[model samples]
Target: MSFTDFFAIDWSGQAVERPKGLAVAHARAGTEAPEIVDRAWSRQDVLEWLEQLARDGTRALIGLDLSPAFPFHDEGTYFPGWEASPVDGPALWQLVDELSADDPHLSATSFINHPHARRHFRQRGDCGDLFPPGRGRFRVCEHGQEAMRLSPYSCFNLVGASQVGKSSLTGMRVLHRLRSKLGLWPFDPMPETGPVLVEIYTALPARLAGMRKGISKIRDRETLDTLLAAFGSAPHRPLPRYDDHATDAMLSAAWLRVAAAQSELWSPTLLTPELACTEGWTFGVP
Candidate 1:
């Protein structure tokens, strides 16, 4: 199964009227550049957009910059000590979907504010105890990323700039809504055809482009162009204002174009059925 196009989304978990951080970009099979699909998008808009692509029979590999699952193994379960803890990734997503069914725009406030479940996440005023400082607050896959020197934060820590907890939780709502329309890598068997979604970390591709630490945001046109060049993509002229989000989305799409061609990325040597079904692995993480 080969992909004819690639997409990458830099998702935002904010519950604002409009999220400026959310960006989408795509690269066609033979295209020399990955173009931004939209300058701004709400979570619902993204969901509908992907569904339309699926309806159109577009066979693309989609990468989302968010953790698809939590640190289940390290904590024994997402909601430890709960009587009805989810058994796997699907169940976990379903629970979030059910909890946030009334949330507008696929926002995950309910799950984030749940009385019991809220204890696992770090909110504005209160920092969750599930992940303490100076100690590891990561999933098994995150540990693997750490081994490679990539600082992948835990999905439960939602306080800092690098934290992905909020975005990932909100992403669950979108994933649950599109589960039937798109195949989720590792969680669902790779379909012989049609669109498929995979969890992506933008840092992986940025690192591949020689991006170094201390430089979290890529704002320079020359630097962005240099990164895109690694994937054979044309340089960006008059680069967009939201360079961080745009570049992240663009570079991620470019990375997917090359990474998807490698059979090993789809088949990690250490991936087990349990890991795939529970703590999802980040695509491109060996």
Candidate 2:
């Protein structure tokens, strides 16, 4: 079964109800450049939009810029030494949702502040006692990403500017709420008849677009359109101020449209049945 539409969501974990950092872009099954879905979006807005996709019977591949699960293969447990540490990806999502039940706007700040869960993540100045040493624990697929000369960070680190911990936890809330309504790749298997959401690392496409490390973020329409053209897509309409979030979304969407038929991406050498179930694979990491 082939996908007819491709969507890439640049998600944010800011405290606001509608994060300005959140952006969504769509690309159809052709060479036309993908366009950003211009609007301020709350996490709820994205959830509802995806629900609409299913209702409309859209055959799409949705990509979100976040890790679907924290590292599970390292040390054999997510929270290691903690009895309540989740054993797998879906359970981790459920645990984050349950712990962050009171967090407003589908956020995960509450989970970050939880006494038990709090002990596993690094904060602005405090390194959680449980956070692994020496660059932190990495999922098996992330090692594959590293093998390809792309940098991959631990989803457990929350302190630096590039940290994905908070955002990823917030994503878990969405995944938990979204799984019943739509198929989540790896975690739910590739559904034969519906949209499937997969974890995406924008750097993968940026590198493929000829971007170098430390300069992957694009801030101009000219450079972005240049990359789009390389993907066999047209130029996107210019935003008032170009940002990495929008560019990442646009580029990934276009690549998804062009690369969806590549069987190697679906069957990566590093991806295993256990990792598919315990630590979800990034869609383009092969």
Q: Against the unseen true structure, what C-alpha lDDT does each candidate score?
A: 0.83, 0.86
lDDT of 1 by residue, 51-131 (tens): 998998889999999988888786778778677779998888899989988887778888888777777777668866654
TM-score of each: 0.94, 0.96
Q: Candidate 2, residues 68-145: lDDT per residue as tens digits?
A: 897787677778777888878888999999998988999988889888877887788878887767788889988988
TM-score of 2: 0.96
Query: Could you tell me which 10 consecutive residues in candidate 1 have the lowest summed lDDT?
Result: 128-137
RMSD of each: 1.6, 1.3
Candidate 2 lDDT trough over 10 residues, lowest sum = 185-194
Give stretches of model 2 more than 4 Å off: none
